[model samples]
Target: GAGVSQSPRYKVAKRGQDVALRCDPISGHVSLFWYQQALGQGPEFLTYFQNEAQLDKSGLPSDRFFAERPEGSVSTLKIQRTQQEDSAVYLCASSLSFSPGMDEQFFGPGTRLTVL
Candidate 1:
């Protein structure tokens, strides 16, 4: 894809359910980031992957939230034991270089996860 692509644009998960959201970034991008946005709030950083290495995950809300970029192009964010508070939009963004904050990050449409 020429741009970042996220699968399952919308997802409904029952309480305690597990969900995995996928992200396919623009080819050859060097940085990928995962974020969670609650209702009306801004996106909060969840993790960051530079190439195939997960260099930062300090923003993950809990142990139940996990993300990975195995091949440096595609990534997945997995949520375990879904709860009402977990209902939010999971966003994926990719940048051309390692400095995502300074580079222009191409964002996906995001995967909205609704936990009921």
Candidate 2:
């Protein structure tokens, strides 16, 4: 019955650094999502997974952004060649189902990344 969780609450990276962020969704949840929140902006959807299958990745900014959920519960988001523009908060959310109208998503505290 644990809630969604993310690791490395904060990260400081130099330009061109590669970083990996982790997320652990609530147990038995069927849907997981990743979002990016830039300063003073609302969170933007990055990708989504239904179980182990990545159903949508249209929101990923570039090839440098990658996400995976191999076993359906834990996920990782990786960014390569970090830039100052990439500094933002990464959030993870999970829902009991993938239905947009039925399930409510629980969000993690988010990981703040600062690229210098």
Q: Number of the top candidate by lDDT?
A: 2
lDDT of 2 by residue, 1-116 (tens): 67899998999999999999999999999999999999999999999999999999999999999999999999999999999999999999999998758699899999999999
The residue ranges of model 1 lying beyond 4 angstroms of the native Cα positions read: 99-101
Candidate 1 backbone collisions, by pair: none
**Reference-based TM-score of each model:** 0.95, 0.97
After superposition on all C-alphas, the RMSD of every candidate to the true structure, in Å, is: 1.4, 0.8
Ten residues in sequence with the least summed lDDT for candidate 2: 96-105
What residue pairs clash in candidate 2, if any at all? none
lDDT per residue as tens, model 1, 37-104: 99999999999999999999999989999898888889999999999999999999999997525889
- Badly placed stretches (over 4 Å) of model 2 are none
Candidates' C-alpha lDDT: 0.93, 0.97
